[model samples]
Target chain A: MNSVLDIAFTSNIKRVWHPVFRQFGLLALVLPGASLFLIPWLWMLSTAGKDTALIWKTPPVWIPPVYHWDNFIKAWLQGDFAVYYLNTFYISGMNVIGILISSVLAAYAFARIRFPGRDILFIVVLSTMMLPRQVTLIPLYMIFSELGWINTFKPLIVPLFFGDAFSIFLLRQFFLTISRELDDAALIDGCRRLGVLFRILLPLTKPALAVVAIFNFTWAWNEFFTPLIYLDSPKLFPITLGLHRFIGRAQIDIQFLMAMTIVSTLIPIGIFFLTQRYFIQGIVITGIKG
Target chain B: MAARSSLADFVKRRFTQRTEDILTAYLCLLPWIIGFLAFTLGPLVFSLVLSFFQADLFTRNIFVGFGNYIDLVQDPLFLKSLRITAVYAFVSVPLGAATALAVALLLNQKVVGLGVWRTVYYLPSVISGVAVAVLWMQIFNPRMGLINNALKVVGIEGPSWIFDSTWALPSLIIMSLWAVGANMLLYLAGLQGIPTHLYEAAKIDGANVGRRFWHVTIPMLSPTIFFNVVISLIAAFQFFTQSFIMTNGGPNNSTLSMVLFLYRKAFQQTRFGYASAVAWVLFAIIICFTLLFIRSSSLWVYYAGEERDE
Candidate 1:
């Protein structure tokens, strides 16, 4: 009966949809869309390598007549992007470290420990995810300003130490997936709570931790508005803010601006390529669960 | 021996293992608790209170209860920003989701070099922030941009995109579609999760390709679609950095989003009270929209094995 049914139904469907045509059709449809997405990046490269004069020429150059390696150097020096790069890295590093420590502990507690108000507190954490950042932007600014944190990296770096909502939530979900048996067994074998988290749970939850770290780093590195609001001094600006400032200047060459823009984009793109698995896994986990 | 036994007895009597567990949990949660109070709850309450007063960041604090809210309703620019934001969110969210779904469906099929294709599409979404704004600024440049240059090749003249008031918002909406790869990834994950047996069953039941897709794929994928829609809608409402960088609410406030308007009010203009009011209104709108979607979700969203409340 199964063979007959398979032959009748599957074979009929197979005949109706040829594999070659289906494959060809998919490629034909997808390749155009993919190329369209590539245009901006390719155009940035093309324009960045062109002569400053040629960048704005009509029927714009898709390829530079000659590659301008000096454009990157000129743009980098022009914007003091070295300082921006260091500042961004510092911020991202601090955020990743703080997020890991705080989120891991909080997530472990929420996942494993039964405390009074645990559920209520977890609900509060979840609701904060829904609370738009704009709603708290002004008051946070005011609070930070009162503390003399404005124009310093403290405002950017310190709040993250308290544990971000998304990171904690993601880590918590991951911890719940891990068996409590491993934790209990560790405890029975004379492990402390932190020890179980650090030794047993942390080793197991490495993927989740990587996801949290990668995302926090990318977000901190790409962060523009926070730096825009907090950092007034050009010397303290991250790459995003620096790039914004670079473009705001009049008499700036288009090629040079594109060069700086490309420079600002490189690290995040490189990070994405290197850690695409964790990045996509993070998105999938959050998307499905949330 | 007597001292050790007494000490152990005292410790055990003072703290049960359950009590110790609770204490440990709270200790672990202390950082988040302090943060929640300082960053989340405190600011939330403070923002609400500030909305009632008229204050610059400094010393102009004067109580004008409901005055900021009233003024916001009457203010034309505030209303305009709301409309612009709604229109942008409504257009961009669905458009992005649909495009993402389509791409995901295409990619779900038997294809070679899937990784390369996926990476190529997903790469653009990763290079976000001010970089995206700058890249698209050049891409939409009327004279020197790729779009216009390509249009010129086809003998069609393109409008001054980000510069023209009429086209600026639409230009942004178009620019937004380029980064749908993130949503596409979500959809791909969802697609993979849908059991293949359902499709085969539909085919066996004499359902054609189109029918099989509609009956099998759509229902199965509805949950994911719903998720993407809610997330994208919320994100769209808060859209700022791009417009802030690319247009600065320009070509006559055509691209002025609620967040951008609030930014101008608070940061640029230092009307902290007024911006707080705007923020509250924006918050209310976001809540209403999210609730509306969730409330209406039962009508369309299908979770396999879960019984609907019909």
Candidate 2:
């Protein structure tokens, strides 16, 4: 009595019809849906590799007539991308280190230690996570200006050492899942507080740490608003601001711009792929725990 | 040997014990506390004062006693920017969430090449801001862009896109879909979290695919939906950079987002007090929506293994 489309779910018909009918049925549903997500990236890649004039050709060339390697070189040197990449990577590295140390320590305390006012403090941190960054943007800028930290990496890097609320929450959640018996055993084995944290808990929390690292790295690398607000010097520009400047002040060579876009995208894409499982797992855990 | 060791251990433990546990805990929490004070709470408190005072980087503040708020009401462009932003957020969040959830449901099935599809879907979201915006700008270019070229193939004329006042916001909304992968992934996580036993029970009760989705999946996924809704709404309100970069708040200020307007006001024109008032107004609006959503969530958001009072 089931229609062909509903046959996949009907128990009696599914076993008989699944081979071609159901599989192809799924393909019909999945391919078009998948293409909506996939085509834009493909177009970007294609456009990046194509000739500048050929891009606007009326018939729309899906395949490039010839690959232009010079676009990448021009965008790299002419666009001042070397300075941007260096500044962004350097900021990202400092951020990773700062977030790791602070978030791990804070998470460990919240998860394991007994202290008065701990619950209230944790609540405060969680609430801060929901607040949009704009709420704090103005005052933070003024404070940095007062401290003579504007136009320097101080505004960018100094805050990382103070722990991000989300990172702390994430690490704390991960730490709670760890067996406490390991802590007691480490304690009885002539280990002290820092020792347990460094050797046992930290190593066990690698996935969580990687998630924190990935988030900080991407955030610092791509952060434009903060850099725009705080840094006045062109030399202090992160890649995001540098690229924005490129779009505004420089050439409109679509070919070169696409190449530059690809280059800028590579680091995050590389990071995502390298930590693929961890990214998925980390996000999943966070979503479920929420 | 055991007796001797036990006595020595007892003495060591007693010596190591201190009533400084509170101090030790605080040491761990020191960085966050400092950060909270300096970056978050400090800025928040200052924003209120800055809103009432005509303050910027150069000039010392002159308190204007709600003059900024008064100007905000009279300012035509401010109201226009708010309307534009509200429209953008209201339209995009629900549409984006629905598309993301739909794609997630499709991807959740036992489809072949799942990894390829997932990576492809998530690829654009990870690509960062300027790059994606630049790419989309190219895609939305007036005549020679990919979208127009495709439209040509279908014998339909494409609008000037970001350049055209009528189509600019829609163009941005369409571009916003390119990164629905982030939302899709969250929904996927929510979907996978649903227990298989529930599905089995539904199947035994003769529930069809549509019925299972409506009855079992929806209620279970309500919490995730609520969370995404609130988060996306906040993000939508804070939208900038794209409008700032792509159209410079546009041909007729059609795409002049509130944040873009705030950025221009505060940084470009150096009207810090007015900008601070704008930011607080934005914050207030966001708080209103968030509270509204949170209150309404209780009517439908279902947490498993828990019962709520009517």
Query: Largest TM-score belongs to which candidate?
Result: 1
The weakest ten consecutive residues by lDDT in model 2 chain B span B14-23
The window of 10 residues in a row where model 1 chain A has the poorest summed lDDT is A56-65
Clashing pairs in 1: none
Q: Give lDDT per model, in order.
A: 0.90, 0.86
> Model 2, A140-220: lDDT tens per residue?
877888899989999889998999888998998898888999988987787776678889999999889999899789878
> For residues B1-310, what per-residue lDDT tens digits would candidate 2 score against the true structure?
9999999988777555433446667889998899899889999888988999998788788999999999999999999999999999999999999998988898788678778788878877787777788889998987778888888889999899999999998888888888888888999889988999999999999999999999999999999999898889999999997888888899799999999999998888988888899999999999999999999988999988764211
Tens-place lDDT per residue, model 1, B39-137, is: 989999999999999988768699999999999999999999999999999999989998999989888896877888888878878875688889899
Candidate 2: misplaced stretches above 4 Å? Answer: A1-20, A188-190, B1-18, B306-310
* Candidate 1 lDDT by residue in tens digits, A63-116: 777999899999898889999999999999999999988888899899898889
Worst 10 residues of 2 chain A by lDDT: A5-14
